[model samples]
Target: MIQLHSGSVMLQGGVPAPIPAAGSGRDKTMAYQILRRHHRGPWEGQLHLTFDSLISHDITYVGIIQTAKASGLREFPVPYVLTNCHNSLCAVGGTINEDDHAFGLSAAVKYGGNYVPANQAVIHQYAREMMAGCGRMILGSDSHTRYGALGTMGVGEGGPEIVKQLLRNTYDIAAPQVVLVWLTGTPPHGVGPHDVAIALCGAVYGNGFAKNKILEFAGPGVAHLPMDYRIGIDVMTTETACLSSIWQTDDAVAEYLTIHGRPEAYTRLAPEEGACYDAMISIDLSRLEPMAALPFHPSEAVTLRELLHDPGDYLRQVEQRAAEQFGGKATLSLTDQVVDGKLVVQQGIIAGCAGGMYDNIAEAAAILSGGDVGCGPFSLSVYPPSIPVNLELMQNGVQQALLEAGVLFKPCFCGPCFGAGDVPANNALSVRHTTRNFPSREGSKPGDGQLSGVLLMDARSIAATARNHGVVTSAAEVDYPAPAPVRRTFDGGVYGRRVYFGYGKARPEAPLHYGPNIAEWPAIPPLGEELLLQVASVLRDPVTTTDELIPSGETSSYRSNPLKLASFALSRRDPDYVPRARATQALEEARRSGAIPPELQSVQKALSIPDMGRVQIGSVLFANKPGDGSAREQAASCQRVLGGCANLCYEFATKRYRSNCVNWGMLPFTLAEGTDFPGCPGDFLYVPQVREKVTRGDEEFPALLLTDSGIHALTLYLKNTTAEERELLLTGCLMNHYAAQNAAENRR
Candidate 1:
């Protein structure tokens, strides 16, 4: 039972309800006012940000530091903390995991950044506990770098974005229209943060309600929520396809900062008398019900009661979706799990930035505090956000209660989030309280013939279902009185005792140690006169996320090894992507060095083209909608390495991917509706004067015929690009741009 109130909204414990306030039509939100105060550009579609700060967690810090080292980074110019919660297991990848831990320590020492060793705390949770402050800006490598709930404007972007920040570069973008998410009423009981998030995602996800827009959470509804509850809802705003989000901070927030021992960070925030909103989405708190986001995507949400009454119909629909997701391979089955008129689940996991929150876990523990999860193939696991959190939970007896309940409590790690922990048996169903439930994310590889699917749910509901022995159940239906959490202070001693901290200290003289697998990027050929591609991978899906593009599991090791990682591009979706892309790469290498591979002879023979070993072959990829999740630049850089020259998409899923393309020197191309393209595998579409056109910002561009398919023109455009971005594209890439910039500076 979740409902939104009509007056001022507030969060009671983990529930969102309304608070009383004077009627005001429009008021500025804390987030909006900060963004407004720091407004740098009306460059129409351009926004340039020299981020006020940057942050990274255990999983991301290694890769970000590796990239920065490759680009000649000396020391961090701003505060940067490298947390180690993501790789706490240290059992799976053998020494490599520990190797990364060691490398992080050394890098932090070398670069003058703070290092919070494995198990200290999860990234966002730690940030909330220590870093977030009013009227500040932050950039993070992970997608959920949002602190709007705490009155700080934060963004989640790819590793390259972090690298740029490390180099003291600005995050260039267009001014996003700020949309006021007016919350008028309070929510009913039994509803948690996940409910509000699911409801919001259902409303704006498909329609792109807040895409690239500043989501200002205001109205009377915001004042009623506790700091943690608001943080829970705010962090998940990224799933709504919003650029960023912020709310009005009140005594609750100040109390939060004070309780966390960071009282100096709190600052009262409010909007101006009248704030303008490009659009408004008013959520009625009381109307929300217990929700469930089915398999595949978060947008497939339905009320739990509606789903439980007749799940066969909905389960069948999800099975069909699974089929399409697996490309009709029928690798994973959802309907088969139905037995005795109930959907059976084998595993329950509450982990990651979303589920590892203090309140959610405490609430879940209260529900399952004493009950034993019978040992009948049903397993329950919990991952606290960080080491400090885990210690606190242990000190407070929450850990003991979970242990007594037969739940396996593990140290902080992102293994389950990326398929490294708690892998379900083939043909098993697992319910999770995590960030995403995309295919293969549950440790079952469709390509490997393993079949399992994860269903996303909140921690409380998962606990309720666990309490019911895996039958679908809502947590709100359970009755329990929760005890006060025995508060525990952060034991920074562990960090100080074992980890390394180089706050105001920097050692630029220390050299980076690159592993053998770490290879520099290959030289990219200049734009071709005519294009030729074999349509190597054609995904007609509505949208393709970055996780599917390069995969996170097999490629995690190669994260620091770019060339090594490129070999696994599209490994999950198209196993042949690597081979096909490699063939094209051989062509590019041959054209560059005048040494063509054996495969090129056939192309020369067919087209009667000279085998002079100097022919350019630009690679191609076609997807209906691509680049949805993660700001990983590797999604594009990996393609560039495999001879990819351009992407032919009906539409791009996010602005970040398009930005990635431009920075990587790839043409972000699109075709009109019903525009049938003959370009297939074994052919290519070359772009003429591409570098010039990008430099001059051409509205329409012509394609030169180079391979089997006739040369055709397509319309391609760029969003507002910064001078730096344009220079990078024109010079082929940032490396080249920096070289040119330096040479010009030297000459001057």
Candidate 2:
């Protein structure tokens, strides 16, 4: 169903030609065209981008605004929309969530930004409705900020990137390779966008086929899918580790923008006739089947038919992987879920930006029209993406139909997508239509001996499985009449009633309210002349996600407080990481106060540095590959707060994570391939004159790995850093850099 080509290919006559290009200049793909228009730097090998708009959610907006405020931000320079969806529940933090919402509202007024109230809409859905436009670029603080289906190039990154835009700084990066996603053949009924997305992820994610590249969707298959269908597929592009995504716009896209009350935002976007791509992913949509990604990752996927054929074998593999991931801390028994050669799931959920679209919910309601989710442990719940979608569902009677069929209808919230709501019982299996199925992402605390598993599927299959009384079933096998298409009528009144439209209207005198849980960032020192880093944690996992770095769900409530949130860093993956990091931090604190802890006295003597005052002590984490999942800056900020000064990895999983590290002033160091890192936890690695080398634009640095036996020499590389990034690192962090600049301006 999918074919991957790893060579330069030209688009001639709307088809990819597998011959090498004979040209000298860069072949401008659709992504390049959109980026070029937004590029502030001179047209060259690199791009310095200034997006048309920016966005963030409640979990992120509070910290982003706080950092900007500390950096002397007067008002938003562009349209900034802060949506309250992640922490909308107000159940975990005891008035803190709502306080953050109020702060968001006040910030919107005080800074001339837009604010979408709690339950009004999720961040991406709101952006799709109001922010996305053809040939426009958007930068967001969420990883799934993909509006490519609407012809908008949405790049999701850490909050610091958005902060740069707020301060009129540019997002700098080397020119990215573009991948052509040539789609052909129309999908059959019962095959949803999630199905195609899962297959694509399975094909590309593991091998890094499109990592840090742009995916340009083109060809005949693009015309067959509806706007929402395209969106469902496009949002999952984040799972493929791509930088951004864009689709060729047609009348369907234009109609989607027009129906959302933004007719002028519509424009045709397609690659030029002879555009070239660094790689090509050809997908035959008609050949796609009902699929599910098992626990641990979205890439660990297989067709439902293939899974059912060998249930025991496939499930045993999942069990073994769970064991390896959790280190036998918890038990995950997927094989036990198979009863008499049939798989049974305990829960079904269709929620969030990926699954909660109007058509997805409408189709699910159609499948469950008269049939009831049988009384057992099995239950079904549906969440609409936005208030407008909910109103349309009600108007079309899909809501009533679902309610009559004993399916629970929830408000517009992103809880289900990230383990905030609808968590299953211990050892139970949940089939969801959400964006991810990563381990412990469904709110299970594996370290505490409580564990559950999630399998990702489309809403139609979940509905069909619910109709089967929890037995695994495919939607294609079910005989049901297709519901008549519902003409969506967007209700702008819903948003106007609840949302605070404060853009272009700054109330500088507005008093900002702060919850007691909200706190200022702790002071971080700038990079010193010499650095001594103790290895706090070493993870050999092929890929480590951001969820494992700082965790999501309940822990997100403390994002506003750096110290409190830092305590949960790597709590799931490494239960002892925080304590070790804290200990390292205490040693550094003591060193700053003119005292060296006895633990590092041996190291001080070994390095022949009698005066420890000249060197800085911090923590370092080693991983094969890290930063795979969320674009949340807390993943790096929490490490920074815990005295983490460097990350040693074979390679970074995504550009956003690396950017987060740079923005946090962490040394994103990478060793050469096949180079052995002969250091473990409690060992020290020292680099001399690091600050001077970084500022001098030096990429290679000789470092010493100090073990108990002896000292070993190793080489580390810091590649592709821009001039401003180096300054941020040398100045401690982006906030510190900006604060110093502001102070200097005040003196001038």
Which candidate's lDDT is highest?
A: 2
Point out the worst 10-residue segment of candidate 1 by lDDT. Answer: 1-10
TM-scores of all candidate predictions against the true structure: 0.91, 0.98
User: Candidate 1, residue 248: CA error in Å?
Assistant: 1.2
**Stretches > 4 Å off in candidate 1:** 1-29, 36-45, 70-72, 87-89, 328-330, 482-499, 513-519, 524-531, 595-616, 704-722, 746-748
Candidate 1 lDDT by residue in tens digits, 1-748: 2222323433334233344542232225454456546556563445567677777764566667765665667789888878776556666555566677777777777889877777767778777777788888888877778899888888888776788788777787766666667776676666777777877877777877678777777768787666666887888888777778888788888877887777898887766554445666778776776677887777778888787778789888877777787875446667777787887789999987888877778877888866867778888899888776777777777888888888898777777877778988987888887777777766677777776878778888888888877887886677877557555466646545765668679887765554454455666555554444556787877888888887875457666566777888888788888788887777776666776666666655554554333345767788888888776678888888777877888777887787777667776778766776655555655454555666677656665433454445555445455666666666665555555555787799
Off by over 4 Å in 2: 22-28
Candidate 2 residues 537-576, lDDT tens each? 9998888999999888898888888899899999888989
Instruction: Show how many residue pairs clash in every candidate, following the order shown.
Output: 43, 0
Model 1 C-alpha lDDT versus the unseen true structure: 0.72
Q: After superposition, how far is residue 123 of candidate 2 from its true place, in Å?
A: 0.9
TM-score of 2: 0.98
